[model samples]
Target: MNEILEQALLYDFYGELLTSHQKEIYEQFILEDLSLGEIAGDAGISRQGVHDLIKRCNRTLQGYEDKLHLVEKFLAIKGKLHDINRILDEYEAAGDNAGKLVADIRKISDEIIEEL
Candidate 1:
């Protein structure tokens, strides 16, 4: 997957850990796909200030992930799903066991997502 997509997912997964103001600015910059200049214009800060804000926000998000391990857990679950998919798809010529494995994986993934 793309690094940008991963970063975006990590941000979302850890965003609630940040202050509300940070959330608004970050969402505007990342999820909204707005440019730094655009965000700065709305936030009444300089463009460089907006850039620094985003950089600091990214660091804060990473800090939360490092401490809470929430992002790590989510990423691990996603990796497990990918592995399960590859296993099922590659053994398409196998018996019903693959179908059962896929079903089990889905069940486990659903439970994990619920906990998240």
Candidate 2:
């Protein structure tokens, strides 16, 4: 996955574990695409301080993902769902056995739910 997308996923999964301040800074830096200097000016910290905080947030979020593997599992499931969608499209184009395709999709969906 792309680094920015991976970071966004990690932040989505683990951000609430961060303090409000950390979350605020992280959101500005990552999600909002703020420069460190801009964030520092808004937050009344030095540029370096903003940089360090973002780095720390990255490390903390990555650490959580490393230990829990929720992000990994989520990405895998998302990929599977995408594959399922592509297969469904193919089945539709083929114009045969729609019932079987629906059943297969349901089975895959059920297994995903069970895994969760």
Candidate 3:
């Protein structure tokens, strides 16, 4: 993933675990894609202050990911579901012999949710 997306996911999964200042800087940097200067100006601090805040926030976010990995697991499950849905759609469009394949895919998806 791109740095922005990766950082954003870290925040989404672990924002509640972050300090208010860390969350604020992370949200502005990752979600809003604001420049360091912009964030610093908004916070009434120097550009370097914004840069330091982002670095500290990134470390904090990464620490949570290292321990939890929840975001990664969720993404994996979502991707698998999307793949199964695509297969089901294709099978429906193909018709007849693929009916069993669609049934199999649905069964697999059920199993995936059960695993979740």
TM-score leader:
2
lDDT by residue (22-94, candidate 3, tens digit) is 7887788888888888898888999988888788888987898999899889889978887888878877887
Q: Indicate whether candidate 1 or candidate 3 has the larger TM-score.
A: 3
| Candidate 1 minimal-lDDT segment of 10 residues | 89-98
lDDT of 1 by residue, 40-80 (tens): 98999999998887889888877877788876777788777
Candidate 2 lDDT, 3-96, residue by residue in tens = 8998898999999999999999999988999999899999999999999998999999999999999999887887787688777777777877
Best by lDDT: 2
* TM-score between candidate 1 and the true structure: 0.73
TM-score of each: 0.73, 0.83, 0.78
- Alpha-carbon RMSD, each predicted model: 3.2, 3.5, 4.0
Q: Pull out the clashing pairs in model 2.
A: none
For model 2, what is the C-alpha lDDT against the true structure?
Answer: 0.88
